[model samples]
Target: MKYLKTRFQWIRWAVHIGALLPLVVLIVDALSNHLTFNPIQAATQRTGDTAIILLGLSLACSPISTYLNWKDAVRLRRTLGLYTFIYAAIHLWLFVGADYGYQFNYIVPEFLQKYYLWVGLPAFIILLALAATSFRGAMRWLGKRWKRLHRLIYLGAILAMLHLALVIKGDALRLSGDAWKPLLAGIIIGTLLILRVPRLRRALLSLRHKPVAPAAVQLASPPAESTLVKN
Candidate 1:
């Protein structure tokens, strides 16, 4: 039992390190002047990308647990989710605080003009709510409502993908320019959501646990040996 506990702790620490590695790299790059000409834009894009990637990973935990029977993945979901929120918050700050100098007049006008911002803001808000209620106390206080509220993550992911697609320079429908990232994200997110379907999940579980049939034994060799011995 002690060994198992130690192993689990190691796994959690590994996940933490892996999740934070991007942020560490980002900071190092920024300090070293590695972020390109428009550092703010680069930072914002990186943070946003990391946030969505983490969110997708968090969403994957359930399917991983169900299909691969890796219950440890479920335990990592909250950690991944919180990291997603952290990255998202940083992305928001980079846009509003660093990029716009926290000027609402500029930010509000841009938010009104940009359709992507419309969706992105809501997605961020959803993540904010989720992050706020992710604590043990909130889980206990909300009871059944906690689960229902968390389900909004799926919606948030959808909106996030849309925001990403819309932010691309070229047409997303035509799969041009930077559309590939969001398109790929959409495919992965869609598959994950499909895996969550009750019927599909049950089918996958049944297939995973289905027993293999034993091979038929060949008895002809035994009879042949007996005949040769008798002769």
Candidate 2:
């Protein structure tokens, strides 16, 4: 592929594999019937985790390219974002169909009780809007509004993180394997936001430039401005 020749081709491919790996593992877990003791919970949890992480990665692509100057990164953002939506859709479907048995009567009561469910719905809705407009045609149609709309990803990420943190039955900060998941996810989301800061993005991108040694060496010190004015 011509696009493969772009700089950081290896990284793009690496990301592709990394994005899909979770799905592979999930599928394996499903086939082996080892997802969890509660199949519905397992499917919903795994899918939600996959979707959130993918969305985080999609959010990261811009900052990563801004820092690395890998133009190809822009191309991968849509792919990663679409994959995030796929996983999210499945997560929702499993929750509705398998977990609640398509019974909104039960889900509505749970939704009313759980704070996380309240927070997560908005994030999921934002994800829905983003995915709907992810295509090039939508990008063209929306123009400037597209950027503003897609920027909601940050808000979505924040809500998603809070949803997970609050949804945990026990202390998420506990010293355990599961405890680390939300913590690490928050760290990742925070770091990506930091990278997006204008000054920080410029500073990080500046590192890619090597000092122009020939320009420095070829130049001689100039006389003071006062000297030139006198002449």
- Which candidate has the highest lDDT of all? 1
Q: Which stretches of candidate 1 lie over 4 Å from their true place?
A: 1-6, 211-231
* Candidate 2 weakest ten by summed lDDT: 221-230
Q: With candidate 1 superimposed using the best TM-score fit, by how many Å does residue 104's alpha carbon deviate from the native? A: 1.0
Give the per-residue lDDT digits (tens) of candidate 2, residues 1-231.
Answer: 245555466867787898788888888888899887887788888888898788888888787566654556677888888888888888888988877898989999999998988888898899899999988899999999999999898898899999888865567656454667788899998898878888886675554453545554347424452233222
Q: Write the per-residue lDDT of candidate 1 for residues 1-231, one digit (tens) a residue.
A: 346445988889988998999999999999999999999999999999999899899999999777765667789999999999999999999999999999998998899899999999999999999999999999999999999999999899999999988887777778788889998999999899889989988886665554534331234345654443332
With a 3 Å backbone cut-off (N, CA, C), the pairs that clash in candidate 1 are: none
- Number of colliding residue pairs in each model: 0, 0
How do the predictions measure up, each by TM-score?
A: 0.87, 0.80
- Pairs in steric clash, model 2: none
